[model samples]
Target: MGEKSEANSVAPSARGSLHEHHHHHITPLKEKKFRWRVTDEHSPPEIYNWTLYLSVFVFGILGSARGYDEGNISGTVAQTSFIKEFGLKSASLTATQQANLKSNITSMVQLGSIGGCILAMYTVDRFGRIRTLQGVCVLWIIAAIIQCTSHSVGQLYAGRLIEGFAIGQTTTIGPTYLSEVAPKAIRGLCGCIFAGAVYFGIMLAYFANYGTALHVVGRNQWVIPTTIKCVLAFLILVGSTIVCVESPRWYMKIGNPEMAAKNLSKIRNLPVDHPYILSEIADINEQVNLEKHETEGTTIISMIKEIVMTKSIRYPFFAIAFMAQVLGQWSGANAITIYSPQLMSLVGITGVKSLEMTAVLGVVKFVSAYLAAFFLIDFLGRRRSLYIGISIQLITILYFAIFLTVVPQAAEKGAVLTHSQDMAGKAALAALFLSGTGWTMGFNSIQYLLGSELFPLRIRSFAQSLVMVIHFANQYGNSKALPKMLLAMNNFGAFYFFVGVMAISLCWVYFFIPEVSGRSLESIEEIFSLPWYVIGRRGAELCPDHSEVNRVSYNVEGTGNAHGGDIDYETKPTAEFVENASNEGLMKSDSQSLEK
Candidate 1:
């Protein structure tokens, strides 16, 4: 941790002249030499920028509810009150009921997410991120209203479908909104909220379920849980309506430069003449120019094709898509989140005593996820966290698999067994806590950050939309297959299956996922150079500067192969890189001269 902090401390000054002479360069320190304030950090406090913090907080709250809803359902059903009230009691009613509830809830939510994601992608620039977030919060309210009045299972499913759309939209746009608005130093951590909120939601659900089910919440039991979720979602809607600000970058993209500059200053808590603010505005202008060219000649389909066909673009896609899903999911993380109680039972953790142990596991998950959020943007950076987290995940799952193997009875008899071996079971419980700890370290935090960072600004929304679609598909598949896999193959089969996937995923990550820890979204070319094959072979050591930092070829020659050759870490490229006329006219001037 100290090592990374030291490296970052050296970053800003380390490359002082790297691109300082570019066409558009601004330094507030030189231009506003006489005008100084005593702010500790670069930006002002939230009090002065209360509107911005309020906006982010509101979205965070709304987003958190969606996560809570998704996570809570399993534990909610596990409650005796829910099982009894919902008629999920009889052996005949169990399988079909469980599958139906799972499918109806998850599918509806995911399907809505697909719509929400699509809408956000097209309309974000038009309506703005804050507006979209505020607007989508309405879906949560409507879903809540319908759920509160639901008389049948069918009605609940309808509500879930509506809620799903809102959740999908939130996932697609929320991270980008946070990333663009946050300071560069904390951007990774800011983006980490997308996943952190989900885990927080899980924690909320766990505690809420325990509070209402275990404690006394009155006669109309499940009503309190459902109603509380509804109210929280509604409050998010109201709060966002009152306080959220539109993204400044989104404003610049749509030709509202004045408002963009104004909002940027407001959100960033900067003086109008701040140097970093000037850089931000310059970057926005660059983006605007790029967008203008795009409007004249590009179609979304063509853009998608260009990205896929372009070797540089395809590499990040392969890395993120493979790692985000495979490493994140292959760890059997979701199973623990969605089906821990049942899993505990399978592994012989049952009765009141077992529930207490599971509670400890939940707390560990909560604490570890919090640790991830703290380290994610600040200490580990994005790619570093993924590397360390994913590596740990591989090791833990292997051990988990081994643990399941050794305790063969955990498979055949279920986790809830007779008390003949209480001491042995206690040891097993400790192991379970360790497994949960491992999961939160990498699995919980990596998903959202990787999804958000793996694409360029132009295609971020679309890429994340596609990523979420796969995410829910996998969720659906796992939810459907898991119980049966557990019962049929028993715990051993389930563990082995996930271990196989994790092994393959680790290889993909080792080979492909680039270190994007602290780079700007505009600087994605670095990642583009890392092909899946290379990532498999070299890991982060590929970058001449830092193994994790990806690089791009700005060389007009189009043949320098910044991404292709054995990485030249020992020597640096010369400055007099000539433009290659033979290169396609699509090449930009800044192509070569990309620095270490």
Candidate 2:
């Protein structure tokens, strides 16, 4: 404890010395060029190598596990074979009973996810991200086998419930791993791969379900999709075991500085003692040291007090992540995703055609997610990207609300549509696709991206675990009640509710959430020192933009080779850049969005 506390005090001078040495050694190499460079050249080009990209990509694939579960269940429940095999096709069942049965089947997974999330709170910190996910893969495999061979409704429910454990854990662990491993330069791009995979996973499940329904028969129909889910889980397990390295930040938190340096070096593809590796480890230690001084003890109650009462330390990080989940879940994206078939049918596209349309909607969502990750989140900045996505959602949802009001098709029972109404229904169908795009680009990415990035490393696992608990809770509640909410609120009222929530989300975001696209994780801690109410509006202005810092570019070797007279550059470590940012105009991070 004393050592970590003392470590922070030495970083500035140590970094300053290292910066001057590197500047004198390599600054003259202006005419030299490397094979590749991080687009902004904020980081050593080595950090952007194939090893880092592939590692993050493989870890990112875990998002598909959650996506598959969400997508598969929606279509799986609609399977004729599944319905008949599970006795859900009974003619004697009343409408309410049928709704209750389907809700039970769908929501049991969420109930189990709540348990898995609680477990992740401990295991992610205890076992590390890679191992926790490996354990998750094993649990999911067990669940998948149980689901595949189930002969009765009770067994099916049990299998689904058990599978939720893996889903719950994956949701917490996936983004955390991505954020830790990603270089700050492409953190938004890399972190977003996890979000993008959700869309891909959904698309895969929808396509799988569609293919099975059209081509397969008997118990095999549901079993085949279940098998696909199992295979994906297995693939993730193999990737974790064979490809990815342990999160170096997790190692630093656990007091394994040697291992932390080694792993960070591995991920960055630099030498174990590279200056960047040493500096990063120091930066991470500074964050840990800072967090330690803020709290009184390691007890649960003490932790709670720090998060809730401190108001300046953990509170903003905690609250930002927490509210992002709450607002995101209520934005009605998941509900729309799970009920795409029913909603599509409401617009007069029925039978297997509804399933087909839902799958296409999944494609729209997947494409939008990629667009946000690859281009918007880092380029437009987090706040601006969200605004763009919300604008799209607002327009689409309002169109839906107005169309439902005018048509009154879903609000009434056995109402035959007039010619104009039928044409308008088609347009509503198109609007639903548009809504999928907006939701993916905005709420879905925010929930995963911000939830992972907002917290300090010390509380990240617990924070994310708590967030996922809320996440699955919302998912469970919506999955169970939305079937009923659709009936009780009337279809249009439900969308109207989402419309109100979205408007509030926009305003709340503007007033309470800061633009955080280009800030370092360690630097983020300083932002909360401001009054909470203004943090969102003022936070972006507080941190430095490292990528914009004028630095001599390094060559294929970690630092540039000795050359002619030094090119114009400053000698300061990224950490010192953070302090400079507070007093000067700016200091550090790896994106241009901060320049805005």
Candidate 3:
């Protein structure tokens, strides 16, 4: 605890430029320069160079495996050829039966993903981050082969389940590797890249299917997209071997500090003895040491017991895991992402137009998620971003829900709709587009961000695995529920249920999430240590002052904020950094902390 405290505290610095020009060269201090606002801000530009990026991309690209399905599955199953090849169009099958079959095909991957996530819980640590992803990549290729060559429905389900297993492992490993390998300050940037790849895969798949639907005919329509999955998996598998490096922290975790330093120096383009390398290793060791001390023997049951037994860890874990299902999955975003083509069909838009709109939805989801991490979350702060995003979702989805409830199409379709009905239907499509934007900015970003932000080191693996499992389970449940719900009530029932939950989610967000933007890895423990009721509104204010003081917390005044929030710290430094600093007390008004 003493060491963790020292890691987050920064002394005022009035002398120096943040390091620039790299490799064993600690260039002589410049003639004159302004002080560093915070410690991690002292990072060298060398850390941002080519080697770091290549390594991040090698693992980050794995997100595409999960995302490709989100975009392509709807379009793939919608194809004329796929429909006939699987007897989906047969007069013998009822509409409900056809919907059931399509739901199974779309959701089998999600079901498989749940199992894979469970497996990843074991592999991620045992096999290590890089090797786990390598194994999953190979598994994905096998899954893709089955997916592309399937002649029977049973075969397709088998392939998708296998594919889901691999994708689950990839997502689990990708972010873990990105966080561990990238320089601490730029870890946020790498996370955005991972997310962008997911959406990019979705967007590319959407457009590809839209193109194939128009340009190609016959069984080749679905075959091309399935084959594309294999190509993507192959690329990731090859990139890992050629480009990625083992995480330095992983070496430390396994009790090889010397090897950890070796890898850290290579990653940072610094000598093993460089001050930066030593400090980073110390921080990793502190956390790793803490993790081992607390968990002792790491196991799922033990990890769960660790959280349940500790109030500080328990509150945050339960808070986030609940949100993963409520705000993340059941809030209707995944349903919309997975079943969008069908939703478009519901609004009197079918065939080519439905596929095209699905393509557009992909564009909206990809752009908003990618940009929000960099812009929205930083500019708006975590809590407000969720508020504004949910507001957008509330308005758009409510309008769309009302449209469905009041429409003639809600009852039974007439041959031709009145002009007013047609215009209202167009508005409904726009509502979906806007709703998707709202979801990405609000729920999607926050959910992923909190998974990384809120937990202590010891409980991180179990908490993440649990969160991910719920996420996929919700996705699978929603996929099955939508078709059944629409069959039971009107289509609007699901959205009404979603809107009601979202409205509740808004209140929940206000009373739960704190301003997590600029808090360091160590200080997060202080914030979550508070009682649950106050953690949301006052946690940041009440916790130890570790934020980079230069950042503005909100727009309350035009002048610079007294408490600025920088990006969250990727690692916590050791006592050596704090003791060595010139304590002008920058953290006090010289930078004084706000202590409760």
Predicted structure with the largest TM-score when compared to the true one: 2
- The global C-alpha lDDT for each of the candidates, from Candidate 1 onward, is 0.58, 0.74, 0.71
Candidate 1, residues 82-197, lDDT tens digits: the string is: 56655555566677566565545544665666566666666565677867776776777788778667657678778777777777778767777876676544556566666667
Q: How do all the candidates rank in terms of lDDT, highest first? A: 2, 3, 1
Estimated TM-score per prediction? 0.76, 0.86, 0.84
Model 1 spans > 4 angstroms off: 1-56, 91-108, 216-219, 295-299, 351-359, 408-421, 529-596
Instruction: For residues 446-520, write the lDDT of model 2, one tens digit per residue.
Output: 787777887778777887788889889988887787778778876788888888889988997787777777566
Worst 10 residues of 3 by lDDT: 14-23
lDDT winner between 1 and 3, please give it: 3
Best by lDDT: 2
